[model samples]
Target: MDTDADARVAAGVTALSERSTERAGDEFTRAAWLSLADPRSDEELSPFADEDRGWVGEGLRWLVVAAVSYRVAGREARASRRGVEGIAVARDLQTTRSHPAQRACLDEFVADFRVAAGMDDADAAYRTAADAYREAGDAVDDPHRLATSPLFRAAAAPIEQVARGPANGEIAVEWDDLHGSDPSDPGAFLARRATYKRQRFPSLLDRVVDAGRLAAPRGTTEYGNDSFRCPDCDSTDVNWIAGRTLCLRCSAPMARA
Candidate 1:
């Protein structure tokens, strides 16, 4: 995907995170604090667990979608809540599960999320993570499991749906609010939606990507280096802004090698 297309996906994911966080209230705030707080025993942190599980679980589902979207886009997309606080919230949810496989699935999701953030090609990493989540979701047998919060099933639905085609084939993303007019064409959808986001939530979008740097840091590779050359203009004058590397000469987003 081109840089602008990638930026749109990032904005859409960021919007999803922000909406979920707003609904989750203190659950997100407390989890974010815990993620940054000094190490404490599980018992010490148990007090905050009384917060609303429904909203927290919903927020977590959004995180999963964001991660899946990044993998599907296979580009430099940023998500606001998926940063440090987001992972902390996911870990807290994992601890509440007694099902071994479910916990393990969440572990794989976090690991893949980190791995995808650092890689130029995250298709395989995310695909593996999505598959693991699907398998875990399918393992639930008991009706009681469905009655209680079935995080795996709820969170894995989008991943499974989008990744249903051939293993090496292209993915068709169709999230309701996230996609634009043509849902099947993710690039077109994101690019169009980005224009709307730029005009409507301009400030919010900036804040989201800026804050997301904590989770997905753009590396310190110098611009003039052989590896950092802009693919379009071949210019070494590139700058990082809101997680995108853009060439100063042509104002095009530079793809990293």
Candidate 2:
């Protein structure tokens, strides 16, 4: 039987079917991350787990999706204090997302978010992703720029930073909120919450990392996606921005790349 990429990755399978356990480090990883939040069952996460180390910049995207899932479920789970299912799903997803291939160069993202999901620390994931927003941008201008995956324009728009980067990622939640007076079943709550998120953020992964690039003081020299260009330097280090091909460097409007 043929196993999908996500399942393979989850089981620690090699990237290539015939090759040894080596990193593909090519456009495939780009394709994978860009589609992780595609709302399909193709399993984009599998390929990303073994991509080249440089692609770690994409960690923000994964972190963002995981954070959203965690937050929504965590909230509902708390409201239904007796239900551990929501929390379980959140913890598993967060742990998996938190541990993309080590070569991705995403720093300690996995460590930062593991506890948050395991113990319902939603802020830890979001706050850490916020810091990464700046870091990802700065790396874009470096000699070895932070090469990100394909995504939408607003996906990387600095103005669209989803959650505000609070000084503290931790907050006190009253016990009352846990297993509140809500009358919904735990399973139903999680199902609805997950569905709502999937619909609202169809491309949650793309938005998170791409927004990180935009949120920074700089822009990204991203690859893949549609086409892009810059008017000033004519730099094509761009990606799909809303409806235009925006320049990462000068932020000037230009024709397609």
Point to the candidate with the largest lDDT. Answer: 1
lDDT of 1 by residue, 130-213 (tens): 344334444445423332343434343333322322211122222433224543433333333223322322232223334332
Q: After superposition, how far is residue 254 of candidate 2 from its true place, in Å?
A: 26
Best by TM-score: 1
Tell me how far the alpha carbon of residue 150 in candidate 2 is from the true structure, in angstroms, after superposition: 7.3
List per-candidate RMSD values in Å.
Answer: 16.8, 18.2
Which stretches of model 2 miss by more than 4 angstroms? 1-63, 69-107, 115-144, 147-257
Candidate 1: lDDT over CA atoms? 0.38
lDDT of 1 at 244: 54
All candidates: TM-score: 0.31, 0.24
Candidate 1: lDDT of 128? Answer: 43
